[model samples]
Every structure is written in C-alpha cells, then in structure tokens.
Target: MNATVNPLLVPDPATDHILGPADARVTLIEYGDFECPSCAQAAPAVKIMRDHFGRQVRFVFRHFPLREVHPHAELAAEAAEAAGAQGKFWPFHDLLFAHQHRLGEAHLRDHAQQVGLDMARYENEMRDHVYLQRVQEQMQVADQLRVRATPSFYLNGAFVDVSFGLAHLQQAIEQALAKG
Candidate 1:
C-alpha cells in the first residue's frame, strides 16, 4: 500500500517557498521563530535529518514569528523574505538561526553582508514595507494551521505528536518513510 500524499509538498503558494522534491517520501513543514530558543535548539536536529534523509525528504520553513515575546522576530522573518527576493533566502535563514541571540537591525545588516549579498540592495529591500506584509501572510497561515508555539512541525501534513526534539523528528521521519 502507498501513503497518502499532499500536493502541497512541493511549493506552498501561501509562503512562496519550495520543498526539496515533489516526490520526496518525507516532507517536514516547520513553523518557527528566529529568536525562539527551542527553534534554535532544533536547528542541529533538522540538519541531521537533512543529512540522513538527503533527497528522500524535503523541508519547508514557515514564518510564525512570535512578536509578543521576540520583538525582532517579525523583522527577522521580513529579512529572510527580502533576501529571498535576491535568491539568498536559505543563507539568510541559516544566519538568522545561527545568530539567534543577536538579532537586531544592525545584526541583520551584518548577516546580509556576511551572506555576500549586496548591502545596498539588501538594505533597500529590508526597508520596503511590502516584503514585511508577505511575512505577515505566512504568520496567518501558521495561525490557521493551529501552530501555537515556536518549533512546531507537521510531518507530511500531520502534526508531529511529540516534543520538538531531534529524536522525535527522526522518529517522525521514519514513520513518514514507512507510510511512503
């Protein structure tokens, strides 16, 4: 028997983000905040999953920036989307997670520079309020999906039924693969 598949596994129109592969046996959709310690902690686990699964799995990140707690969270999400405009989203994403503690406008600028993006262009994009709207749209999608906190994930479109730990993620991936 074959597992039920979601067409949304490829590219999500709401977020304008693409997963790794259309036919990937496992798909992970993560709703996260840049400044959330839990999300930061989960980063290495996500890396391990990517390393272990390779092309067999796909990962998609959605913005669920918890503004009430992390003041700069929305800004970080905007920055990532702005970088996406220049085809540098992932680099910006990794940098944000890597420097989760030091997220500020100045830090965002530094990351743009570190990622080898044109500072002038990145600055302009960041200041553009339109891109921020896009990030808000992503947040709305997360809310509709009932994502309550940082580092919540959906494996193959179903909520992961455990804490956001690496071992739990690995187990979810294994289950997804088995279903596939």
Candidate 2:
C-alpha cells in the first residue's frame, strides 16, 4: 500500500533540518532519535542516499527522542537544537550519532566544541528547555503517525517504511524519482 505524507509532517524551514535543498522534487523526512542505535546505523545510509540523489532530493531530520527507552535521547536532541542556534546543527547531529554511547552532559559539551559552537551559549541553551517545544511538537507528529520507533521515513510526503535501511529507501526514492 502506498502511504501519503500527512501535511502536518511536512518540514518547516524554520524548525526542521533539511540536509539537502528544501525545494527538491523528492523530499524524505525521517523522525529519528540521536541516541538510537538503529538511527546511528541508518545515518550513513541516509548520507549515501543524499550523495546519490544530490539536488534531486530533500532530506529532513526531525527529533523523535524516545525518552522512556533512551534517557539521554532528549538531551541529545536538545544538544543538536542548541547547536542549530549557532548554525552547527548538522555537525552536532552527525557527532551525536557518531558517538551515541558517549552522550552525557560532558560529552554533549564536547560535541558542541567539536561542531565549533559557542560552548557558553550551547551550554546555557542546552540546560534550558529552549528547543524542547519544537522537539515535543515533532514527537507529537510521530505519535499522530502512530510511529513507535526510530528511523521512520516519509518520501515525497508518503510513509515509505517503519524502519531505516538503504535498500528500502533507495527503492522507494528510485520509484519516486521515476514518477517525478
């Protein structure tokens, strides 16, 4: 069955992080958790897809931290958002996933430094709920979609899969590309 993306889940340039051009014909939105092992595994594959498709695709990463299962997930999301304030979200994001197990107050700070964010600003923002509202909104979006896990993907506004794998994404994106 083909699933269409809910209009509400569409990425807003103001909040959602788009890895590629936002206006591309193919839009892939992933609701993922930084501390999720599955999501960490999927990061490279997502990059590969972006590399393969280039400007033809738009990849959006939204926060969907599973707090019950992953206590550090929310903080990691906060760290990413805080870095975004300094125009370093992508780098922070990559680092979080790259060092998922190393996430903690100190590690988050290290990630901020690694991403070249203003440590003072990042620490202040990270301590507050500055970006929690947006992250909660994305979590609600996942709930609305009945999403129960990390690495969920929507391609061209359609739910492509409940999990992340390069093959599934590639096939769905390839089909969308052909149709587009």
Q: Pick the candidate with the highest lDDT.
A: 2
Report the Cα lDDT for candidate 2.
0.84
Could you tell me the TM-score of candidate 2?
A: 0.93
lDDT of 1 by residue, 1-180 (tens): 125644433346456655477678777888889999889888777877888889898788888899999999999898888778778888888889999987899999888888888778788878876588888877877777777988988787777854735687788789778776
Residue pair clashes in candidate 2: 5-157
Write down the worst ten-residue block by lDDT for model 2: 1-10
Pairs that collide, model 1: none
**Cα displacement (Å) at residue 133, model 1:** 1.3
lDDT of 2 by residue, 63-121 (tens): 99999999999988988899888888888888888899998889988878877888777
Error of 1 at 86 (Å): 1.3
- Superposed by TM-score, candidate 1 places the C-alpha of residue 92 at a distance from the truth, in angstroms, of 1.3
